[model samples]
Target: MKKKYKERSARFRFWRNIAMFLPGVIVAFLIGFVGSDHPIEFQKLFDRDMLYIGSIILYLIIFGIASTYLFSSRQSYQMMEATEDEDEAYRYESQTRRIYDLATIFKGVMIVPYLLVIFFSCQKLIYEEKLTGILGKYTIPLTFLGLLLLTFGLEHQFRKTFKQIYGKAIPRNSSGAEVRELIMSMMDEAEKQICYEENFDIVFKLSNYVLPISLMAIFLVGITFQTDILLALVVVSLIYVYILVSQYKITKRYYKE
Candidate 1:
């Protein structure tokens, strides 16, 4: 049984490594395909020098994905198996909270450009100008680059925190496994209780539908009025503003002051 589980784990890791690199390769291929004047032209570009550049890019992407996987594996170990010490667990929890805050900040920061994309896309559709060029030429690539940099920084933070909490002496007892499972179950229940009491589930579910419906309405109005795209975008931004404000209040209520 143990051998079979280990084999399955190894297989999972093998597929995960390939899945990580595949997205980068697909994105690069799509960009080449879309930017090429003709299919033959794009095909010809993949010769000796270009193949070397592509190989280098592929290696760099694989290196990045491998780095992320290593850090994430360390983080998983810290969360699940390495939190035996009380002081280490406390520090890990504190770091986890800060990481959550960092994630919120990252999402909040990214929302600006996302809203801008909506406004600009609508603006271009309404006014029929050269705004799509800015989006296609700069926004997409820069956003992708930004996410890669952010991922690197986040992994570094996790690595630093994990190293600080990592202990050499792991206490093994007959009841340790059972106790760990009980503790994890209790923590999961507590998190679920908090979410239920806070009505987070309702808010998220509502937002899931409301955001898309609001955006769709805005787009429809833009198509109708032809000059009211900016106005519609303004209305949509206001909806997001309300959502953000409500989220701020909820966070303030739930989190430490």
Candidate 2:
């Protein structure tokens, strides 16, 4: 029965993956077919100025939302501390966790716009040939430094609030072994199993689908924009190197004599 169940589950997963990836494959084929004769004008399709402005606005909005969530989490934590009723305290604790989760999500969301902002900034310098001017010379680097500071500030607050709630201090500069030990100390067997399964799923998806899709998308983008294919090749090469190195290390560790 167990063997039959495993076979059924594997079949289901195979079909599910096909269903998920089919649309993307179809879209890529259609784009290639349609654009084969006529090259797509990306500049006409997308306004660089609008994209730059939109990215900044989106970043600000994500920052505000994440800040609000962090504030609410901190407030809930305070309420949890002050509450005399055990049930009320537990409710506040749950609320705090939920709010903190949202904050964590927005923190990740912020990165997309942050990266877009930097990309557009660099694009401006490259396209305009303004590399020698003070504005162009400092724009990308300054934006990077400023945004990095903001990101680090948000991260620090998130970690501080997390420690307040969980009483687990995640060291700022901990080694891999130390971080792993801290994480294991915080989880029971069930939680650890769930974490392991989730991590496996993430790695499996990345290896099987995400990296391949990304390479294809990057190639398409480079073709469409008439950009340097070297950038796409470099990115793909780095991803392959990372995957190979990770696999080698994992094999070495598990198959050690």
Reference-based TM-score of each model: 0.28, 0.70
Pick the TM-score winner. 2
For residues 1-257, what per-residue lDDT tens digits would candidate 2 score against the true structure?
11333445888989998997787678767767766656666766888778877888889899989999999999999999999999999999889988998998999899999989988877877787655445657866776787789889998998899899889988988899997898689778987887787887787788777887787777767666556678667877688668757988889999999
Of the candidates shown, which would achieve the greatest lDDT relative to the real structure?
2
Q: At residue 257, give the lDDT of candidate 2.
A: 100
Quote the lDDT for 224 in model 1. 34
Model 2: residues with Cα > 4 Å off, grouped in runs: 1-38, 41-44, 125-149, 168-181, 221-227, 252-257
The RMSD of every model to the true structure, in order and in angstroms, is: 22.6, 5.3
Residue by residue across 90-181, what tens digits does model 1's lDDT show? Answer: 77665654454344344334444444444443443455443244465465456446556755565465445434434322223427786455
Clashes of each: 0, 0
Candidate 1 off by > 4 Å = 1-99, 102-147, 159-188, 203-220, 227-257
Error of 1 at 129 (Å): 14
User: lDDT of each prediction vs. the true structure?
Assistant: 0.53, 0.82
